[model samples]
Target: MANEVVVVMVPFLAQGHLNQLLHLSRLISTYNIPIHFISTATHNRQVRIRLHGWNPNNNLIQFHDLDDPIVTPHPIIPNTTSHPNFPTHLQPYFNSSLLLRTPVADVIRSVSQTARKVAVIHDSLMSYVVQDVCLIPNAETYIFRGLSVFYYFCSTNMNLGRELPFEPDKICQLPAPGESISPEFSEFIKLQYDHQKNHVGNVYDSSRIIEGKFVESLKRDQVNGKYHWAVGPFNPVEMDSDCLDRHICLQWLDKQPARSVLYVSFGTTTTFTSDQIAELALGLERSTQRFLWVLRDADKGDGSVGVKAAGPSHEKPLFDNYQTLHSTCRSVGLPEGVAGRGLVVREWAPQIDILGHLSTGGFVSHCGWNSCMEAMTAGVAVATWPIHTDQPYNAILLSNVLGVAVVMRDWEHRDELLTSVMVEKVVRKLMDTEVGEAVRKRAAELGGEWRKSMADGGVTHEDLNSLISYIHK
Candidate 1:
């Protein structure tokens, strides 16, 4: 019966979204179902190269590559400046994604012919790609939300003209739909929103242990009797050998004391101004904590490119490659004395491995959902520094509701420059103070609960079983 069903995954073209759906595909494939993971050729290649925790060469999960869409070059904003327009710069990418509708529909149709039931699961933002799924008699469509149920609940309430039960901070209050995006992108967003209204249900990269109340609230408040499932912290429980070999950060982490090092990263979509980077560097130094910082520019959709390290300064830096460390320190304008205290990586780091390592105590993050899930699963507390989109809401959930993180800056103040003094204070608060310890303890407890939820007979496992059964019926 399982072999008579096929799952088709259509993930949005960003790292966070792509990674979650890929993890979902793996989970679904384990049930003996054939899975088709479709995306542009370039994106498929990117997934293959960056995939960890599992081999992409598995027989049950197959990659279906669509031709790349012709997109104009987006303007390259300098790394030294803040991106005020933010995601508007991603308009070209969004526009290009719409062009995949026909090809995606074609794939769904072809697969439906062989399978008794074709399950089309798409990222919420990519719903337009599979809008025609309803036209196929044997196919059903589901939306995959790559974020917390808490964020979605609040946002949906606001969109429906319902008032929030509790007062929210300015940053936590979500912007109205299409308010912050380009007109072209706004139209694209509308299409997805329209298509979402007719979907069967939602699949979240979240779990009840993290947001049980919110999940229940969404279920009760849903108007059409639609159902949803929380089967997430989508990263695998066991680390594969391939993940261990991907980065030098893991080797450096090996020498640090347990619960000592801070892992700092702003995700793939966020980039700090040069001044902001300098302030952060100085702050990490003043806090006197051992840190591993992944510093890179926002991905521009072309491909990953290495950032050039600058020349050496007077102080000696700590990596195996002294020259590279010295150059990284000089480039980021770190204080000479900070050389031995930190490691700055210019490319992608194995985040899952780093977080899962015993030495990692806290995270300085943009509070993207994927990062939040990774930190939670690894039992590391966070210093929340949200940039845009649903991040502010995730930050609020982490700091205000869950009590697993500390707020470094509010989204309302994201445009203002954060000074080194404030950075040092926040870093110290999250790393050296009693407050930090309390949050760390709570985070560890939550991590334990979430892990169990993924075990047999737990909430996540049952949810996965329910979803598979739904498809089979």
Candidate 2:
């Protein structure tokens, strides 16, 4: 008898990457494909906790907690121990490949011999281990990128070890100019870009999950030579109860008029300097619009949120930014809301749910690919405020290419932050002007188009089917 296709998922340790894989795992399981969701001890627990009721008893999906007692006999899981050292510094993409080397090969070998036809689906960052993963009998490995297609395309095109043709100030403006990008910024992008050099265009030439013709145009490789498939805009996965407080946020939305409230959130792992936060606070207040703001103090960067060229070369620049921003954010105090129309939430909020609500007309976002996808898929217009990494690239994509979002603040390579004036102006423009209405309508229409893309015979659905056929072949 032919065995069922069993996909083994090995996501990196980041929440953003893990969340995407979990959602994708849920998606593939609908086809009755069994999955081996593997992670280190802590990450395995995190994923299991995320899927609380989804896979009880492991009937269809097996959870491999590599850090669990049975799998990890050692008293301590090697990578689970973390210190004040930030993630961007740890360089896990490079280290994790080495760490999972034997474990990944062992798991695939075990699964293939006994019951199922195994396929290894890992984070794009883990591409270094794909070659080893492919060593398993009849096994195939595919890279799953959690970032935007625009960001990916830019990375592939950039010349490593060479100066960009554009000005250093125009790093974010590959096709057009908006913000300044530091030399270190491109360095990080290059690091990620270089990882895919081995398998990206050659290995299943997997499809990117982003959905849009504009992104499609940037395709550098032949139809399937590089991007064999387009897998998304993956619907924003719902957060588990532990990750968010839904009832309070949803109840607040229930009382607002349709498309009247602005839903503001940067992302799960991102925080700004206090100055930027204060500017945002003032902007939200000045716009006179009903809004929901989800804030996390833990993510506040010391100004430079993890863009480093090497050891500590980039620290000083970031530290300077943090000090300036801290004083500014500290000096200002947010006023009480009138009639309790607006709300400020410090803990997590159900971003996907909040964006999808009828009352959410606009999103004040940091333009992370997932958040941007969520807002666009929900047909909610965005007031873009990109902070770092792929965010600025995504902001450019939304504002310049798709016309679904309005860029609130241009990204910068310097020590400056967005002032209240910029924030208030953009908020009012998004909430009170005809331009905002047009963008809002366009967002909804784009959302409808994306919905159609997910339907039968749609481009994304076809690619998904192609992946299935390849697996079954």
Candidate 3:
């Protein structure tokens, strides 16, 4: 008998990247195709622990954990007057991740031998790990983008020889007019860009309904002869009963009126100074709107890499530094008066569950693409506070192009502390004003359109089918 075609997924170590590819894996598995998901042991465990939408154990996807890479310490420049705009703290993790290329290549080679064709789908940043797949006669590689297609188009417009429709400042990934990039982070970016040159096709965690104009624009502008698929809003439509019961926040949400509570979270990678956190709390208290906020210290080490042996020497020291900077953030207490109307979670909150709840009226988000998609799909308006990377671009998409969100703080002002008065103003506008009502209605309409894109004959459905058929071929 002929061996069946096999699909392999390789995601970057970050939670956002891992979660998207895992969701995609679940979607692809429904077609009866066996999938092998390869990653470091720690990241695989993290994804498994936090997995929702589907039960991982019952799925057709198999987890293959690779040995952990040895962690090396990057030199710390003490008393530096200027800090890099990028998250240079993650450099050690990035340096170690590069070592996985040999082992990842081995996994792909071994899996290709047993299958008629091996389709290796990797995160955009992880192309280096699977670069050798082209040498395998029966293996093909596809780059999975975790950001919105619109952000991709805008970021690459100049390189693609297309004139930008918006001002250069609008692309937040680029530095401000006078700002300078640190050499350390600049090298890191250059390395990632070099790794991206080897993919055969592109896979986006976005839908035509969300970015139809950009999708068509990219198709016409790029002459690379590579196929692009917009298969997204990968998050499941409804949370299972078990998932609902697991999070206590949902029970509190049950008591609130529909469209009354604001859900606040800044994603896993963002950290705030104590004064900023205090101002945020004061603002929420002053707004007097019912709210649910997820507050946690940013992950100090590599976001997801778990060292298998004893912790690296640099790990504890780096964590110590984070503690010093954010010590007040952890202990700064919210006012007693706000407790009656607000709920604050110090651990991971069931973000998707909370966003999908009927009580959730608006989201105060960092505008991460995954969070943006979840909010859009749930028909919730957003109060954008974009921090870095593609977040500013996503904020623009929601607040400007989509008209489903309002900007609380733009990336240009990320370093400045936000005062309580400003916070109260934004929160009240999102919750009590007629403008808020209009934004909510638009969000619901867009959400309906996004859902239709995944229905039986919708654009996303068709694109997903096309992807699977290509794998089978």
Give the alpha carbon lDDT tens digit for every residue of 1-473 in model 1: 33589999998987788889898888888898899999999888777776777776889888999998988867545333245535555568767888999999999889888889999999988987888998999999889988889788878887788877766554345555544344766577678877887778889888888888898899998779888888887787678544435466777778889999999998877656556776787788789999988877667776453443222221223222333443542233234666656887877667888898889999999898999999998888999987767787888889988999998987666668888898899889988999888999999999998999898999988888889899888
Whole-model lDDT values for every prediction: 0.79, 0.61, 0.77
lDDT of 2 by residue, 1-473 (tens): 24567888877666567667877777677788888887766665554444321344445677776632222121111111121112233233324434675676677787887645677778876665445654565677677877777665665456333344334545645432212233433354345554464343222111333334424555544454554456665454343434353346676678899989988886644435545555676777777888877655322211122221112322232223221211312211135443355775544455777887778899998777778877877788999876656777788778876789897867542235677888889988888899998999888998887777777988767877777777665
All candidates: CA RMSD (Å): 3.8, 8.6, 5.5
Query: Which regions of candidate 3 are displaced past 4 Å?
Result: 1-3, 72-85, 159-162, 167-185, 192-198, 242-245, 301-334
Candidate that beats the other on TM-score, 1 or 2, i.e. the better one: 1
C-alpha lDDT of residue 293 in model 2:
73
- How does each model score on TM-score? 0.91, 0.76, 0.88
Q: Candidate 1 vs. truth: CA RMSD?
A: 3.8
Which residue segments of model 2 deviate by more than 4 Å? 47-58, 68-97, 160-227, 236-246, 298-334
- The model with the greatest TM-score is 1
Residue range with the least summed lDDT across 10 consecutive positions in model 3: 323-332
Prediction-by-prediction clash tally:
0, 2, 0
Best by lDDT: 1
For 386-427, candidate 3 gives per-residue lDDT tens digits of 766777778889988899998898766666778899999999
